[model samples]
Target: MIEKKSITFLYRTYKKHWPLLLLALFGSILESASMAGLAYLIKDVVDDVFVEKSYEKLIVITSVLIGIAVGKQVGFFLKNYLYPVVIYRALREMRAKIYNRILRAKPSVYRKETSGDIISRATTDVERFGEISSTIGTNIITETFTVIGIIGVLLYRDWKMFMIFAFTVPVLAFALQYFGEKRKKYSKRLQESFSQYIQHLNQIVSGIEVVKLFHEKVFFRYFNRINSDLFKRQKKNRFYETVYLSSVEIVAYIATAGIIFYGGIRIIKGEITAGDFFSFLGGVLILVNSLQTLQRGAINLKALTPVVERIKYVLNLPVEDDKGKDFKGLKESIRYKNVTVKIGESVLLKNINLKIKKGEKLGIVGATGSGKSTLVKILPALITEYTGEVLIDNVELRGYSVFSLREKVGMVSQEVFIFNDTLRNNLLIAKPDATDEELIQALKKAKADFVFRLENGLDTVLGEKGSRLSGGERQRISIARIFLKNPDIIIFDEATSALDVETEEYIMEEIGKYFKDKTALIITHRLKLLEITDRIVVMENGKIIEEGTKEELIKKKGVFYRFSVISSS
Candidate 1:
């Protein structure tokens, strides 16, 4: 049995297609009614034609049978066609909503979920949820009506035989409930195992090079463990499903045998004609088949309980907070006062105080995991949960709408992500309405003039993740986006680290010229990149240990001086 909450969710998902649902129901009713008509007419054919050998009556009965067949075909066509239309349309809407929610969900949610687990919910779990609709359409509507019509015929032919068949209902119902619960338990385990299988596969694909270099045996062992688990869970799930169906079939067979035995006794006593007994048998067979289908549908619904819960989890994830005043342009300064950030027990950033005036270039350098990236990320509202305060133009950072605030900041990170599209299309993500000439100009500014040499120029299809482009070329493409955005503040989070020395020098020269009058924050380990900054902050273990102009820090012979000496050597 489906839980009450699952029923409510499915109703809300499918209620918009009620017109098609009603039409499908009408077709189901017609189809079942046609079956009953055929069974009822079986008596006429057996008695009038087979027994009486009346040619006229035989012709009339044949005509009526032909009409029933035609009606049944029409109903079959309507139910088959309309039910899919309703189901698939609802599924399409559900996929879109899931994607939208994932895109807008908070960063914390991403941390909590693996990409593989999320993908499993969106794809596999959703497809399984569709079984609920199938059960409703096929088992609930069609089979239920078919059982009722056939039972009506059975009662009319011989109420005593119908009574015999009725004795099996309580036993069948109990079996269905018991087996359905067992199937549901295995189904949940099967889905979880599948999720882990997907996650393991994703890890292997993403780290194929690492596996090839050092840990091939280790990764393979992990894969084998996950795969074996998945196989075992799937085997168990199938076993339970088969057992449930077999139990239902056994009960149906017993009921059929009981009816046959009682009907034979009645016919011998002359209580019913041969034609009447056979007609009742035909109705009983149809009813048994319908009940089996209804039981299968119920079991499928029970299996869908876990799938429904998984989908609901994704849809209910918290969306990013976007409610605040729209940020214009920064006029004065960006300041951090006693700011701290933590995730679980890990302190990513501690109480830090820093300030930079508009149009001033600031440099931040720290060892790995010293909170360099985390500090810069706070400016774009990507990490919003922090104590103390971040002020932009003397207003609280949260006071500005996250979207509007992001529009004013341009960040070029070391890990450049290039979509598998033409260079022109990839560049247009920064400024969607930019013209061809504007794109060419931005590429030139970022020293990414290689696009002009490609066979199709901007129309070239970059393979997945820009496979056709070299590291420097990909970095140039990212820089081109920043040039296109032309925001008030520019952030270089080791953005040129992937480029060759010559390419890095050239790109930095171009960037220096473009950002001369703009407020800028440069986060890099390379000491040379600090040449353009008016001031520098040195961080160690989530704290700002030193702050001064480049020359002043070098004069102090502190952490910055040590870093400078190491770079120079």
Candidate 2:
């Protein structure tokens, strides 16, 4: 993680929000100056007016003090009211930057990373960024100005008396300086440990069924011990914060005592008036204490470094951008030749060659983990770094553009992902510009028009991942989505396997109509799907084991015959 000044990042991110920020700084300075000015008027009223028996001077000084008090109230409202709104604006801006990063990320990026952690990084990371994003700027402005303005007044009252306030600031400053690194270090550790705990919490929730079936009740006990250890470590961190704040209070009291004792002697010797001596002491008390308050908040900010770092680490990560050529008017077939995939020391695929015509149905089949899905993922330009010559017409896959290929391709996977939104919107996801008439036609073609019979019709909100819908209904919607897009090519990866035999047959009939004159590719483990595909390609261990028409492959009595035998069993 890189070390950036939180204050600088906060300001640069939201300079436009500074109108409120300016108001806060102005109000704080005026309020601090008013207090010191009121103290000056008190000394004059007691000594020059009452003690010297001058009533006229008393009225004027008293009026000025009253005006300062009223002015301070107005300043306080304008200043205090501005901060939270400014903080809100800053938070939104930073959240937008994180959101934009996610939008620009390639789908492959998520495959290479953990989405659960990435989601936390976007939300919790932005929140952690918020910890520093909102506060440090305003604190630097108001606190610095307030402390400085108050101290200036104390010096003007009596430079010699100002020495008492100065001596103690260094003591508090030393405490803050002494504990700064320790506080930051502990805070960093606590944040990292908490993130790890959060990761574990997600893993357990996702695997609750497995845990239940296995009857691992004692697993929680082990997890509890780990969490308990983390809790103890966090408690230890707060101890450092306690020491930092406690030290500030100690310095403040010592300074308060030093001022009174020294000033009391000055009054007795006639070196300063009794009223002047008392007012000077009061000024010293406020100024010294304000400095202490500033240090305390800074220590708290230092305590947040770990969380801020975690957030910054993610937001600063490189977001992938689709810089591929625009394919608004593409007129070419896709070709794959000699594609190879190797991970570490393991070779997943070797020297695979194939061709996909612009409008032809191509079926890819293989055993589980045979790289069937991996091969399909490459067409969308998902997997970029592989040794191969994939061409859009004659243009190399790497030379042409990702956006160009994506524009004409649509895929429906075995594990369907549906957002919690209207049924209409789910279909419109394929083509946001599609109209109600167009949507219904696609739905009818995919045999999903039964959605209109529901209570909400197109407005029906399918729960997350379409958990509210039955397996067949979800697949129909998935098919309707691709039908709505009417892309040049479609890849169906076991899209109907979960359905009953009759439902799967009905779906197959519906899909054949949808793909009648278009290019369609189906990867199916069920032999039922093979009857629909014009050609069959059997894949074993990532290479094409055999390929022919359904009758041709069965007649060969090889891998396809063995596959049929296994299916019957």
Candidate 3:
């Protein structure tokens, strides 16, 4: 469970207008006062006109009743409309805070958590908070204050009944608060279970191709189990709620019965008139109903505490580590010292040391399962909290902010992804301000000319992740984009591995030309690409085994040369 501080912090992060909440309280008082006044008027009409046979005050009584009605409606309108405005604004503020937290979360956080869990919290959890925020306040404020007002009026009219009612009411509150504890725990579990269900659903949907190929309906058993659990929890919650509601109704019924019996005795003894008893019974219903709603609202407030805490957990997560305050670019080198990248118990890259000079085209080659990708992942400052230092331009990597570090480096992964937009729009992402001539120049540089021959030149809409294009086309577009952006440093994660011999060769020339002086880090199995690179770094078992220029390493026939010879052969 998230701590109390987190929930309180989120609540404080977006404050509601105290004036509005107070106004909601005020409107409720007016509305309840009007209602309570009606009962008094009825008592007066009966006692003064019916029993006393006085017709002179009838016109004044009628006007007073109409005025109460109008005032109640007006009070209701103000409370209903204005209070929701505050609720909506609070919701918007919370959603924004959660989104910013997500944006700045550490990479370690994402690798451990699921996209679906995060998305569910942002969408469903926040929406529930909004609904909770809107309703809980009105119920707690209006119902509670109204009930108090009725009790005060009753106490003034006849202290004995009010005292008895107070004694019984606490028992109902205790029952609700008791049940409320259980509800809060289960509500948290329900959200957690739903998160799990969402996480598993994401895994299944993403791997649907595997499921279909294997024809495995058995794989869906887990989902079935989750659904059953959710159903059971929901039923239990409903049952507990029903018990609380039944108790509240019983309290109302018993109070009514007691009022009838006691008021009748008083009337018979002539201590209180029949007219006052009639008005008292009506007031009793209004007061008890208000208390009932307030009791239920208290339970709901308890139930929503977990959601508020969950939202706060995400919203209050420390914004990702600040990039250093240093302003120097990576003109000299970016060096790593005894760096260890660990994900919880397992380390991805361990005890590594390396450096890349400015204008250095560094090729990082390793066998599959080696930490080649992890090593490059560090340069972009993607994975921090490693064992050692990553320094750029003589300043510690920690000294640079994420904005400064990422702004200077652009990464192109082996897996190509394009937005569902026009080809031109996708390429324009490289340089949003780049001219058409500049864009075409970049496209040609990255060997992306073939895309122009398509029906929509640059305006053509690409389907989801460029599903509209072939694998080679997507790869070329990514390359063209990197070329256009022209960041100071580039990390190519097997960027050319998806291409065939012909496309690879054309891109090899264009890629080398475009990234001539930029600090380039290439993670690839194709060590033969080292021919065009200025330096080569070999990694094995998360350790830097060797480093040298291609020709220099080839003559030695070390690991780089061996892979090179095999790839060539």
Candidate 4:
């Protein structure tokens, strides 16, 4: 069943290379025919050249052997040419498709999968698929046809000898049945072990600082455990492969011995000519070698099931739905009607009714895990699987395409993610066609003018996660993106949280002016940030418990008052 599945996958992935396939087919046929010709020529060499002792026949036989050699070489060249072409092209296409799927897939997919596993699937697993192409392409096609041609030659020489050789087929089949399953099982385990190994590596690299600061014993123990498990699985996999090879060798030697004994008896009795015996020997050698190759290929194809299944899992993930009415701009207001967000048994956002008019500056302040960020996330339709409706201009958020809605709404969060690329490229992600002058102006507005001091200016390449920039500088770059986009609605989720007091005050004062005309929602734990907003909502335990003007809330001495008092102190 796995063999059939592997074959089906190969056919589907590579069917477009039909022209190359045709050439490969033609070449394989020629190769097979040439192989048979070589066997037949052995008979002529013995009978006509040696026994007859004729110089004329000897020259003719020599010429014919040379011709067969040339044909076989030509066939070998053409037949093998397409294997790499099909393998590389098919894998390139597969990688491109998988990468596209990764980009378009919903955020939830990322939550359930590890970064290491995803990377391994895209790189290592795709490579395994490429191996399947080579294994099935060259081994199955050429070897099978060559075996068939040799069998024809053997039957022509002597049917009795051919029958003796054919008996080994069932024995080889039994060997494959038992050994193939074991190889498949071990191969799957090996791949999973590799994933875990990669995940451990990723965790250590991403958190290298934390690992360095903390006691080193815990990390070393964890790594040792993972490495040991990987080594054990790898050892088991190699053991099974050795077992498969050993079984194949035993079967091959026994088959060869039986054929030799039978053929020798017939030759001694003068039942068959020396020429006939030699030709049959040639044919049987080809057949046995082909059988060994076929066995190896079958084992490899079986092992590929785990890789194909892993790739299929990622490709089958539900991509984000982009088919909906186009969104132009926010006209009047955004409304949240009893919206609730849940994941498994945990509720992140409770039923809430709220509205923000066009050009309104709304502030949300709450302790951690109070759903402040979750509440704003719903307005942009990032968290789509909610209980009730989030409407913009009275149109349901789901009614608008994700791309168009996100295009009109921009968000800058506390955790700024900068690409390991140039400052210009990072800024261009917000507005691809923005000119240098426009970029500078936006950078100025966001108080990110530090770019001008760099030797390369906008061309300066940032390190991973913008490690080249300070925390305040990275936050400023993120703010620059928001300013460049100039979306109809802007949401800042503690964009100034990590900055020192001076930098935070500067960023807040600068970015505040940019939000004046746009409908904005700001989430911050710092109560001082709310002074710039017209209205503020205080949340606790996924529900909005207090809402009013900042002054009004302070006068009420409620949750907002308590938050303000705690933050100031």
TM-score of each: 0.91, 0.85, 0.83, 0.90
Candidate closest to the true structure, highest TM-score: 1
When sorted by TM-score, best at the front, the candidate numbers are 1, 4, 2, 3
Which should have the higher TM-score, number 3 or number 4?
A: 4
Give the root-mean-square deviation of each candidate in angstroms. Answer: 2.8, 3.8, 4.1, 2.9
Residue pairs clashing in model 1 are: none
lDDT of each: 0.87, 0.74, 0.77, 0.86
Model 3 lDDT per residue over 262-305, tens place: 87888898888877777777777787777667766655555476
Which runs in model 4 stand beyond 4 Å of their true positions?
A: 2-11, 111-121, 176-202, 221-243, 303-310
Residue range 1-569, candidate 1, lDDT tens digits: 67888888889999999999999888888899998998898888887899999999988999999999999998888787788788999999999999999988887788778997998899978888886787788667898888888888988988887787788888988887788789889998998999888777887788777767895777778888888999999999999999988988888778778877887888899998888988987887787677767876877776677888999998887998788888888899999999999987889899999999999999999889999989999998888779999999889998998889889998999888888887778989999999999999888988887888999998888779898898888888899999999998989999988877777777888888887789999998787778988999999999999999999999999999999988878
* Model 2, global lDDT: 0.74
lDDT of 2 by residue, 402-426 (tens): 7767777778887777899988788
Encode model 4's per-residue lDDT on 203-227: one tens digit a residue.
Answer: 8888898889999898889889888
Checking candidate 3 for backbone clashes, the offending pairs are 323-400, 323-401, 323-402, 324-399, 324-400, 324-401
Q: Considering only N, C-alpha and C atoms within 3 Å, which residue pairs clash in candidate 2?
A: 324-401, 325-401
